[model samples]
Target: MNHPSGLSAAAVQVYRLRVTHPTDSVTELGCRAGLPPEVVVAAESELTRLGLLRTSPAGGWVAVGPETATEELVAATEHEILQLQVALGATRAKMQALSAHYMEARSLRSARGDIETVRGLDNIRAVIDDLARTATTTVDTLAPGGGQGEQALSAALPNDLRVLSRGCQLRILFQDSARRHKPTGQYVTRITAAGAQARCLSHLPTRMILYGDDCAVLPIDHERTGLGVIVVRDASVLGFLRWLYDHHWSQATDFFVDEHESPLGLSSVEAEILSQLASGRTNPTISAELGMSERTVARIVAGLMERLGAGSRFEAGVRAVQLGWVS
Candidate 1:
């Protein structure tokens, strides 16, 4: 586990098996999970360290509630991600594995036209891509978290480009943290340049893809299952999604990235950082909270302090407020 997992697949599988079958031993857990005993042991160690699992007095392991476990998993995963090498042995593997199970159990086409379930990453991608391809007027997406990785973005790029070329309106709203992501930024740049309109909101409703006003696809598991996608053809539910998109869109700012990594004026990122700093957040806290690197947070703080002509962090806060950069 210390060597870094290609994805969190191994850990997630081990955890899933133990959580569902608390009495299972490491060997039993491995057998149930279809992983090696050593892998399950390693994953158990990692999960216990993360506080998601605990060794019961009976010698087996037990999980906390799913909600609590998921939050801990997310934080632990984010920390691990920051420590990973430049290459992305990203979260795709775990996402796919969990989603495959979801599809097997739940994926079904409904005749009533109320709702339907799609299975597998490929099928989800195919449906979403086809929707985007055949969209007559609009394709609106709320991609929260860190945004999709370079590979996912790359695969969807052609479909996205086609959407734009066909004179369809494409609007994507990403979390503000996404603009600071190197690869995510590249994709955003490409899409924006190709006539797609983009915005950055500090928060988002959910990960959803809405084609025009009716058809919609939304993730059901989010932080837990990685791939539980539900296709909602219900007009009322889709209307609410559109309303949610509109609400967030109105509050979002244009994603303005500075090429020089510094702006004569306080850039949106700088302003956001300054706002967090004003709340007396430390460098590490700011980095984790904003999904930015600690070094990046430090440099921004130092630069802002110098630019404010301030001798200390307190003075910088005052300057930022007086300048109306963050209030």
Candidate 2:
């Protein structure tokens, strides 16, 4: 039962049976080892294929001649071990390279003299221009409200387009409101067609732009006036922006607008029903207010509930709020 080379106890038992009872068939070997006959047969076949055992018509199954079986088993095991070792070495090398890159980026950012707070539009624009000029690898951005105008867009768009044309990766996140704007949606579509990745979220946090690891462009005005804020050679600030983007990205829904269907543009009766539901009116009250029969109102409510995937009137109202139908 002791396997020095880490083979399973079952494998060791099967090997021992083959060596001890050279004339035994697979069924007899299985019985001796208290294993199922099928398991013993499979093991025997594998061993024979690996040159660890020999089979003969007259002798049934037997260990390979002399030390050949032992040598073959040892060689196979060593080959497997060497493969694992090589894989481990490659994995370690990759980890080390990534660690070195991260450390070097941190060092470069730390060495940049005096961290400056962007207080106005000019300061923000200066930083953005510098970051855009310096970006070599990729850039990720989330701009809400179609705020990237013709000039800014004209400048950044070309660089982004160039990057896409050359096969560098760029991902942009936008707010749902921005998609309703024709120009913004057209820009997104154009860049997307050119191979830049873009998605729309139900909501986006404050406007921000990241250029590789070295710089970030944020809004100076909380209301996103033409003002911009820039952080140059600041790794910590860039890291914070990256984390915020990831958090929003995970929660944002895919940006597929179904033009043929409208969930919130309900009919007159449906609109009345939803209004009553949002106002916490019971079905009977809703029926009286709309001058509809109780049975009819109940059916309409049921239909709306099913469409919205809600379990109750309260839940339906909550979903309406989420979908921007109510409040």
| Top candidate, metric lDDT | 1
The digit string of per-residue lDDT tens for model 1 on 169-283 reads: 9998887878767887788789889999888875565688888865788887754325668888777787888888889899887776332232447665677778878878898
lDDT of 2 by residue, 22-121 (tens): 8876677788899998888777766666676777678666676537767877998999999999999999999998977876875566464435467665
Candidate 1: Cα lDDT at 291: 56
Candidate 1 residue 215 Cα shift, in angstroms, is 1.0
lDDT of 2 at 143: 70
The parts of candidate 1 lying over 4 Å away from their true place are: 1-113, 257-327
- Candidate 2's TM-score: 0.43
Give candidates' CA RMSD values in order. 22.4, 19.0
Per-prediction TM-score to the true structure, in the order listed = 0.49, 0.43
